[model samples]
Target chain A: MNHALDTRHAALLLAPLTLLMLLFFLMPALSIVWTSVHGGQLDLAAYRELLTSALFRRVLATTFEISIEATALTLVIGYAIAMHLARLTPSARAVMMIFVMLPFWTSILVKSFAFTIVLGDAGLVNRAISWLFGTETPIPMLFNRVGVVLGMLNFLLPFMVLPVLGNLLAQDRTLQRAAETMGAGPVRIFLRITLPLSLPGVLSGVLMCLSLSVGSYITPALLGGRTDMMMANLVDFYTRQTLDWPAASAIAMVLLLITALIVVLLTRVRGGNVEVL
Target chain B: MHNSLPDRMTRFWRATGGLIAWSGYLFLLMPTLILVPVSLGGSQQLSFPPEQLSLALYEQFFTDPSWWGAALQSAKIATLSTMLTMLIAVPAAYALVRGDFPGRRFLNLFTLSPILVPVVVLGLGFYLNFNLFGIGGSDLSLVIAHTILIAPFVVVSVSAGLRQIDPALETVATIMGAGRATIFFRVVLPQIRDSLVVGALLAFLISFDEVVASYFVSGPSTMTLPVKMYSALRWEISPVIAAVSAMLTILSLVFSVALIHLQKKSRGH
Candidate 1:
């Protein structure tokens, strides 16, 4: 029968993806799990040691702080853009989407390089400020938390806007139109009608922004100074710097745990669609 | 008659909202666009608004042998990985979209799971895995690692495209005595060709832009472009960085426009 042949074709098709993922992805990931528990023999000592370290605590705290701050700022900026996009005609939306997606598609290194050009001591921002205000001092923009957040916010804002716009567009607009016809004040109409309706998008945007910023390494590494460190930086430090594979694996597990727990908890709370890309 | 209190208030609100929205868009574009003028900068220093307009940075980047070597290595890796990823992902996407296979959800999750892990961890995994294989310093390892990183994008893109197609056409092809492979090649593949092209381009971009994994796996002689850029940013501010930034931005914009145009054309059909 055709059904028999179709099943075989399906299995044949799936074989390569299965094999490559198992060999390349699953095996390497399992090896990390194994490494975390085994130095000479099976144990949880690596994770224990990692948890007990002051550096671990500081790095985790910093990662969360930066991610939360970045997500908040991105939500504000992204919500505005998505709101604007939600009202546009299809052709105009396409053009605006290109600009938003440009930074998303560009190399992270190139985007960070742009920050180096703009936010450096002698960079464009500093140069402009000096000219405008006649200040002799160049602001300490790069190599700090401000620089790190600014760079990361550039990347995360687009992610927030896209999904929010999708949700907003899919939403029912009759209620808003009815409210407008009923003479609800503009600010009151938005606060009472649109904002409440878009909460799912906002929630999804926050989760996406938070998860991405939490794991981000490149932006912070380029923009932040020595004292500013995140969880992924610690993972890199152990893997590359110290060659402590077990310790690195342990920290990675912890990082994954934090991110997964937050995502699971949020989905449970809101029961919203969480389509993060 | 339409200029009531609410209408007037909403118009003002819309004006401010548009202002805020455009500013946000500008903020997003500012970093990438700032490099354009700097790329034309003549002075050796990485300064804004060049002392004179010249293409020295571009000239410097083009003339450097190491830069060429890195670019070549990146091209080789990206092309190889893109080919391999499509070879693997296209079939998988086909199965996921069309098959009555069991454990389909699990298979879908399995393909996308790589993205859930932090890239730093993924890089370390590749580094250690390669070392264990005793192929730690080779370009083969880089290519393989990049394939794993990029294959998921191909799968997802192809899956989306396949989902857009109607199932009735495929069934008709099969009922007309076409074999599965023939149907795929003649009927299905043609429909999803745009997806295949866009997915391959995404795979290439992901491989080309990947730095963390390349940083770990790359030996002294095999650094990729982004890895080289990272190292340059670490030691000194090379004026050539602006040129590279400008070039990469152009490449990305062109690729993105191509992707969008292809998708729009496909959707029009």
Candidate 2:
């Protein structure tokens, strides 16, 4: 259908949002680039520091390392849950979806705090372990990589599960039935028909999880140690503790670039896969 | 269906898969749910399965000025931002969905651009922008930043609502001599009220829960609950936060269920 409003009225309606985005969103974003280049004097000193600084390099490495690990773990666990959800009846799936979506409703800070409560030295897990095994030493979980990954897995699992489940549910059941009628075993049918069809969903889920993991701040800040800091934590450290705006903006620029690159690549890969799913 | 080797293996796989899947669900629900009992504990120290079950922490949250003060401030800011976001996003959603204009695609993409940017970057950008304007660390700055952060969701939600409505209604209104503004206020708004409410609730929740940008923009004078919780959590795990967390969990649970209901209503329409 054709648009209801003509250009003049449409422009009038759209003006507020356009102006808001430009003034608040676009200009502030540009200010980051300007600040990164020595307050618009066109110097690359901040970028140079980002490239050469050992601390920055290690933080970058840690960011990628933790994100990749978290993404892998989320995909594995998320896929299992999604697969199970797909097999259930629709009414059952609707009930199970609430459990899947519970984390999304809770604030990240609360969830992170909950993790600390559960995983701390005197927390429930250690208490359970010590009680059962008759041991005094608690397994160190909090303020480490384990805590960060666990928190991230909780936050990111829904992102992975929803997309994969969408694809799994969208798959043709007749193909599986036809394969079964041809004497193909359940395992073979799953491997050939279901798994291959679900690849797009898995890919989309992976990209979403990986992107979220890479830029995540709250989890790492609350649950991680100094060495376990992600790029976002580094951004916070530079912005707040060190009072280094240039260094912070430079780091921000790098993060923005990486995220944009991933999104661009994902869209390219996802273009053809849309119809398949 | 009988116990052939493949059928038995399939059953075993289903059983184990269900176990693992349920374990994953437990992991998702456990952390947040565990906070309730922790909040009920009567001690300074944080422990699960509370040593003494009491309403001590809950009482403290209500009585404490700093915690309650921050909560009120967050509510104020979230409300303002939600209003501001809807003020802009509703019209934009209408235009994007029903109005023909130049740069329509560009406008759609521009609205969503904020979500693509890492929030930390947006936080820093706002920090710098507000500092440049000499308005850094103000409630107004935080409100503006939050509106920017959450506008896209409102726009998307309202746009979906707009799409589902019949265009013929507007066309009929126009044919019967109603103006665009009249139709929008009289005809369109009522039709999309459920979505608008859902979107507003979502905007409220997001702005209230926002931490990264608020951290940079809010000052000691205007510290939000999440920002306060964040700083406190960074240093030490405060027992009071468990009460705060429990309350927040309940609040979000209520809003989320309401949102689900409103969504179903919107879709059902």
Candidate 3:
């Protein structure tokens, strides 16, 4: 009776989630991969087309360039903030941490719109510049790479800060004190001890920011100019505007492949143990 | 290259670090602050200092039927999507945490891969599949799409909570002659209740703020607030958009504060 009851409980606990995954998560993902390859027949033509297209090559390069810039900026800024939080009194740390997280909890779309207003031609920055400089023309800040990078960094910074903060909280401060007592200077201790110890968190943050920034669709679309269109935007245009599923799926597959490769390379270089979440 | 030189260099580095940290804080805060005053502007175009300050735009958002209707529809979809995500995530998280089963690792990855997949691809897949079923532009489609998108976050959070619990507590309760269902309800549920709430709240927020998926799946009448804002921003920047954005920003801040409070309380406990 106990065995039978155990089996029944297991079945009851597992059935719903399993069914949902099979229907929604697994099926849709599989269908996307399958459709990309065999929407009509077994063909490498879509893959071939993407590889040979100069437009795609440029888009891919731009995606990587933007993601790298965003990742680098997030790390430098996030590290300083995390260090400050670590050194703060507990109550002050908590309050400041909440402030750091404020933008993250807000919708990315809302924040992007805020950037648009602040950076637009007739917007605040330009208006302020015109008043100060007595200039007739508003600065061309929006619809450029500067606008897109600023918008992307606004979203990516929190992701970088949180992971590094988690690692800092988990760190032992006594080691730093011991190093100081052993005649090591503050810079020497930080470089030799603290920085190396925080590598796990730093790598985790880098991978997370890089992947998200690369896959991001909305920020670039809204803040970017026509020439700044990334791979995700191209996928959207092909699928929505051009009505080309095969081509869209092909682009997605390539995106997935590149992302997967980068993740693999990151893990390998970082010693293969980082939780991305 | 001497002892006093080291002290001076350390002090200089500390000041530089402090300066960078404060600048970073400013970078994060300034963009968010720009929206608040703009929402209060009286002009049709967006401006920094208002020639006139009026509540007319906020009033328009409240009094206008189309705006209110879109807000209501978005709220309804978000609510339904949150419910669906919680329903799916809780049991899945439970099994992954407690059940020692085959393919569990694969299942975990399968659930999370949605986040890694580009949104455009997911949107395309839904557009095609929903169109084939004749449900492409329905409210139900949006709800289902968002549920899939957010369930993984729910799973991760709840699983983290599960890992934190001592399994021996549950084992002891079982050995005390409590039935499995009784143990699960009386012992397990109460322990993880806070985490479950946090997870569900996060799911709700994700669904509430969703835009790209809604843009493709929603009909004209079923458009969410973000979709409306997106369409408007493409043509013009008005204080009305600012009004809507300010409302959302405030709501999100409230939720974020609550989430932080809950997290601190849970950690304390």
For each candidate, what TM-score against the reference?
Answer: 0.95, 0.96, 0.92
Among all windows of 10 consecutive residues in model 2 chain A, the one with the lowest summed lDDT is: A268-277
lDDT of 2 by residue, A1-277 (tens): 3437888888888899889888888888999999899889999999998888999999999999999999999988998899999999986887788788778878999999999889989888898899999999999999999999999999999988988999999998999888867777767877899889999888888887777788999999888988998898898899889999889999999999998887776667577221111
Supply the global lDDT for candidate 3: 0.79
lDDT of 1 at A66: 91
The positional error of residue A102 in candidate 2, measured at the CA in angstroms, is 1.8
Q: Supply the TM-score of chain A against the true chain A for every candidate structure.
A: 0.91, 0.93, 0.87
Q: For residues A85-189, write the lDDT of model 3, one tens digit per residue.
A: 888899999888767887777777788788887888877788779899999888786878888888888788888888788888888989988887677887898
RMSD per candidate (Å) reads 2.2, 2.3, 3.0
| Reference-based lDDT, residue A223, model 3 | 90
Candidate 1 chain A — worst ten consecutive residues by lDDT sum?
Answer: A268-277
Window of ten residues with lowest summed lDDT in model 3 chain B? B42-51
Per-residue alpha-carbon lDDT of model 2 for B128-174, expressed as tens digits?
A: 89877777888889889999998988888898889898999889888
Model 1 residue B122 lDDT score:
83
- Which should have the higher DockQ, number 1 or number 3? 1
Clashing pairs in 1: none
